[model samples]
Target: MGSPGRSHRRLPQAPDRKTSIQEAALLPISRRQALALGGAALLAGSAGDARAASPQGQLTWAVHVSLAPTWFDPAETPGMITPFMLLYALHDAMVKPMPGQTAAPCLADAWKMAPDGLSYEFTVRKDVTFHNGEPVTAEDVKFSFERYRGTSASVMKERVAAVETPDARTVRFVLKKPWPDFLTFYSSATGAGWIVPKKYIQQVGEEGFKKAPIGAGPYKFVSFTPGVELVFEAFEGYWRKLPSVKRLVLKVIPEESTRLAALKRGEVDIAYSIRGELAEELQRTPGFTLKPVVIQGTFWLYFPEQWDPKSPWHDLRVREAAALAMDYKSINEALTLGYSRVANSIIPDSFEFFWKPPPAVYDPRQAKALLAAAGFRNGFDAGDYYCDASYANLAEAVLNNLQEVGIRVKLRPLERAAFFSAYAEKKLKNIIQAASGAFGNAATRLDAFVMKGGTYAYGHYDDLEALFAEQAVELDQKKRTELLHKIQRLVHERVIYAPIWQLAFINGQGKRVRESALGLIEGHAYSAPYEDVTINTG
Candidate 1:
């Protein structure tokens, strides 16, 4: 608690059932452990009507980097929910996307898109209260959207053409055109067109507002240490029951191995999804467990359009050869301990209608033949860029795979911050990069690679501008799928991203880590996880 001022946010709390944690460990008991523990007493027992009678009730979560959201003003970045991630514990989004459930209400009890197709209305839930104890007003709900559009979020402005509040407790959005995918955008992490407190923003300008903001969620932020840590306390009056625990900490530790080691040593209680090569070992450790949950993310490579003219990769044959040469099987087994899957397509299994029904294509010898036929029989040496603390190792595994085909690889690693900034500019000199955590949407995939100015485009697909213009505006799911499927099929055929496995957004934590999922998995838009899970203390 004495680690200096941490950011403030509200978290939800719930009373623990006496046998919840035990019941959760549903595995049949063993004789040796049962006999030895038959006489041993339970460590902490009993729960009250209000809270856990004995709850360390505090949780510490670790991730590879601090929550450095690029844009807090959601309007600035199209579909970005930086504020939501920042205010996750402190506020809730209107609809939450759970593992199996369709989008359900968080702040607003229910919502409907008008028959006209351009207007969307919501019946704001009147039961919620802000951390400040004020009744959540309909005005507040309307204000969150208007406030997000403070001329700062140009991207948001472009996507959300207009907003109108026709009545108290009702907010309607009238778009320039009918968008059936409206729900998809709102549910997206970046699509959280949240209603920020208009009064608070007026009181504290932009910079001041980011330092501390308000939301109606399960936890309240207390303070933040840039690049170090964030501490949160439970919001008892959360619309949902308060979180079972009293406090939570989101600690940033960038070193992948060190983070895993920290979890093993009990230095931190929880680590978010950790997808490095060390996952299997961590799962095997006693009293600690690994839970592999499906994530809406995919990891792959990038090419700088700026440098494409100078490389042989521009030739489709060479590019395909390179893609074929990268031994995903060996890479997954050696670097990821065979815990990961080789991604043949950019669309991951979690995405709707994603058919993972067939065998993966892998042919290093064929890749060699293709490379030899491409006029450079000797193959070529290249450098790949990696920013993750542990990604260099994955890069090395890739290097080995490529090396077998007479292609030499040099691993280039940059600091996470530098790597990200460089990537944003699309100025990488070489071909090695890893991209993941794309919230599952056809548009998300299209935006990443096919958009005129996309993050993954880096310069590989030059003619994609036309495709993106149409894909971006096509609102019909079936029509959009045809386009998305064609574009992604092109992604594989073109081998623009000599794809690495689609990695889950993973982190590592210790003995007390419980939840397999976290609030941040959805990207920068939504904030509804603090009260979702019930954790009993270690």
Candidate 2:
């Protein structure tokens, strides 16, 4: 398989073909369409003799962000794509994302929902053992869920009434009410699905565990140098096939040019988040491969104090004017090379429940009129526009567009850890550029970013909050979908956020790498099923 052009290709099947057809159906194309699009060829290439005969080698992956120990701890996880880069390697979840499917059973062998939809029972796999040689038990599952302190903890606390371990192998979760998306929430796509060794954590304590963590993932933790690199070795006792690559090194190379140089010089096997002209250049290069995957995220602008009447953003006219000021077409062409789609709503257009609002009008005249009506004829300074280094280009583009409309914004870029820490602590005071590619349906995205008291939420509306709460417990799918549509409409009508475009991630892979699967879903950015990846030695 080579780098795809304008179109997307179906992901190859995982080494373990345990995924269900229902899960595979959730992808953009049907299974038949997938097979027609060279899926069989890809599958055969992944499991062929070449991969089997390849000798185990060390695979060095270069990432743009600096990783920290906090990303490895399941309890303190921030539930974003970046953290999962470490989480997927250091820890194993009860349910994990299948190669081309929604989710597949991992530590948990089977699960069933109650007739009333208020409880879920999972059959824990008895054969599974953590890296420390401790058997994974139902008690451990219960403890992991209870000890979660991440952003998703609010959803868990509100929905999960109690956890019961009837026996060593059976674990049940009693819900506060009927929730249709309960399974998706607990899937590997989110933080709630991660399972940790309870006994080990209690013995070492949370802080100590961060320093040296133990989990049931395919790779065992070797060592970590903060802001530098993380090393891991294949776990011989892993439940699945041992990783084909014996050693894995994740190096923190924040500079894109340096990472590209490392890839060309064979210092790194994989380089992540390659964009703009560099991505196009890498695609044409002989030895390098450019892999582009559509993520379930958007590059958009957020107003932190939009709800405060004292702030200029409190006026709906001003927000609408700001939205109109954005030149999405130019932004998409410049930033994404015309690969990304302009977003109409928070939910991507590809999703079934997506509300197709009209494309944003780029009417500078109307925007100026609206601004003048809102008492800012010569648009006021909108404070600083905060974003991580990775999104500096997009932020700069947004800044220029706002400047055209007379809204002055100072660009402020921070490192990955600092950016997220500030965002979580609600320290961002101005228009901020943010992205979220989390898996799950529209409701999951809404709950995570827009709902009242959400992790990244800066504004709240009581009516929308009540509707979200109602939709959570509504058993009927039709009624729940209707409520979700209403919420999306309200958000767009009120200009809650200035939706820009749905982003596609670009990655560069070297010739030495083979049999690698970069997940089938949108949120699988920077995460891969490493055990199945084979390093070519020829």
Cα lDDT tens digits, model 2, 1-538, are: 1111123232343422233233434433323222223222333234323323322678999988888788888777663667777776777777655454455556765566676677878877658889989999999899988888877688877889999999999888999887767776777436776899999998999898988889888888999998789999887766655668888999999988888889989999999878787777787889888877777667678898899989999999999988998888887776567777786677766554567788877877888899999999998999899998878888888888888888899999998778888988899988888877666667777877899778888878999999999988776657877998999999999888888888877788998987556644435776477777787667
Which residue runs of candidate 2 sit more than 4 Å off their true CA positions? 1-55, 350-352, 519-523
**Candidate 2: what lDDT?**
0.75
Q: Residue by residue across 290-374, what tens digits does model 1's lDDT show? A: 6553344456665554345667776777777767777677666664556566656556665653534234556889988988887
The deviation in Å at residue 432 for candidate 2 is: 1.2
Q: Which RMSD values do the candidates have, in order? A: 10.9, 6.4
Each prediction's whole-model lDDT (CA): 0.55, 0.75
Top-lDDT structure, candidate number: 2
- TM-score of structure candidate 1: 0.77
Stretches of candidate 1 exceeding 4 Å from the true structure = 1-56, 69-87, 134-156, 273-277, 306-308, 353-360, 381-384, 406-409, 459-479, 504-528
